[model samples]
Target chain A: MTTAAGSRTLAHPGLGEITLEGVLHAFADPMRMRVVRDLAREEGAELSCSYFALPVSKSTSTHHFRVLRENGVIRQIYRGTAKLSVLRRDDLDALFPGLLDTVLAAAARQAERRTAAGS
Target chain B: MTTAAGSRTLAHPGLGEITLEGVLHAFADPMRMRVVRDLAREEGAELSCSYFALPVSKSTSTHHFRVLRENGVIRQIYRGTAKLSVLRRDDLDALFPGLLDTVLAAAARQAERRTAAGS
Candidate 1:
C-alpha cells in the first residue's frame, strides 16, 4: 500500500516491546502460522501480502497480518503497491535465542506427522 | 478431587490429540503461562493447584488450569483432596521436542526484562 507521500508504513512493536505471550498468541492461529511458516522458510526475504494463499477472506487475511505485525513476529513494509512481510528472525532470536528455529522446526515436524498420519 | 471412584481423574488430551496451536494458545495467557512456568520449574513433580498464589480468583485460576489441561500442556490428578498439576513434559517433548523448554526460557527472559525495567 502506497500513498501520495510515497510508501505507506505499518506500525510494528519494537524488539523490546515484543512479549512472548503476544508472539505465541499470534502463532496460535492456523492461518497466521501458515504465513509465518512461509516467511520463515524464505529466511529474511520480504514477500508481498498477495503471495500468501490464505484460505480466508481478504479482510480476515489482513487481520491476521495486522496481528502478526502488532505482535512483532513479522515486519511489514510497503514496496510500491505491494505490502511485503518479513519474519523478524533476528529480533526474535535476539529476544529469545533459538525460539524461532525451535518453533519453525516444531511446526515442520507437526506438518510431517499430520501428513504421515493422513496417509 | 476424589469420589467413590477412589481418585477422580481429569480429562486431558492424549499425545496424538495435542496440537501445536492448542499448546501455543494455552500458553498465550498470562495466568496460564505462569502456571506452566511453575510446573516446568518442578520438572515432572506434582504440585497442588493451590501451590501457587495466582493473582486471579480461585475460579479464574481453575479455569486457567482447565485450559492448560485440555490443551495437553499439563496433566491434573487427584492427590488426596488436592488437585495436583504436572507439566506433560514427556508427551510434549515427544510431539514437539524442545518447544516447552524454549517457551519457558523465553518466559523467564521476559520476566527478567520486565523486572529490570520496573526497577
Candidate 2:
C-alpha cells in the first residue's frame, strides 16, 4: 500500500475492527486523548494535525492522528495541503451510545482538576 | 508504599486522575477488556482473577487486574484469601455515563464477528 492509502487505513478502521478496546487503545495516551477532545469539542471544524497543542514532535503527532483515524475514532480527508479530521460522532454513537460524550466530559473534568491543582 | 497499597494504587487511580484516556488505557488491552466485560455482565457476582480464560501467566493476570482496578474501572475488595472484583458501576457511570455498557456491547459484537469469520 502507498503512504496515502496506508495513512487512510490508519485513518479509519473498518466497522468490523472498531472494537471498544481498539477505540480506547487509540485514545489511551494523553496526547491522542487531547487530539480526540479537540475534535469532539470543535463544532463543524476540520482541524489539521498541526492545530493541536501537543507536546510531541511533528512525526509523533502525525502518528497519533493516524492512530485515531485508523481506530474509527476520527474521520480524515485531504483538503489541499492539510489532512483535516473530525470525530466519527454518528458511527460512534451508533456503536457505543453516549461514550464519546462521557469520555469527553471526564477529560474536561480532569483537565480542570489538573489546572486547579497546579494553580 | 507497601506492595498491598502499591497494588491497591494500581487497582484504582484516584477519582481526580481518572480521565478518558486512563480508563480507555485500562481497558484497551484485550485481557483487561475481557475482564471488564465479565465483571460488567456478572450482575453482583464478584469474580476471582484465576477464573478468567486468559492466555497469560498468573503474574501477568495479577498485573492486568491491578491495572483495571487502579484505573477505577473495577473495585477490588479482598475477601480473605481471594480478591473479589466488581465493576464500579456508580463511579464509572458518574464519570462517563454508559461508556462501560457501550464498550461491552461493542466487544460482544466484535467477538461474535470474529467467531463467525474464523468458522
**Number of the top lDDT candidate:** 1
lDDT of 2 by residue, B5-99 (tens): 43432236666656666688887888888888788777778998777868999999988988887788888877556788888888877777667
Residue-wise C-alpha lDDT for candidate 2, range A1-119, written one tens digit per residue: 44654343233576766777778788788888888888877865899888996998898988888888888988888765678888888888877766777677767877876898899
- Indicate the worst ten consecutive residues by lDDT in candidate 2 chain B: B2-11
> Model 1, residue A94: displacement in angstroms?
0.2
Residue B5, candidate 1: alpha-carbon lDDT? 50
Off by over 4 Å in 2: A1-12, B1-12, B116-119
Candidate 1 residue B6 Cα shift, in angstroms, is 3.2
TM-score of 2: 0.80
- What is the per-residue lDDT of model 1 for residues B85-119, given as tens digits with 9 covering 90 to 100? 88989999999989988999999999999999999
lDDT of model 1 at position B69: 92
TM-score of candidate 1 on Cα atoms, chains taken together? 0.94
**Count of clashes, each model:** 0, 10
Task: Assess each prediction's global lDDT (C-alpha) against the native.
Answer: 0.89, 0.78
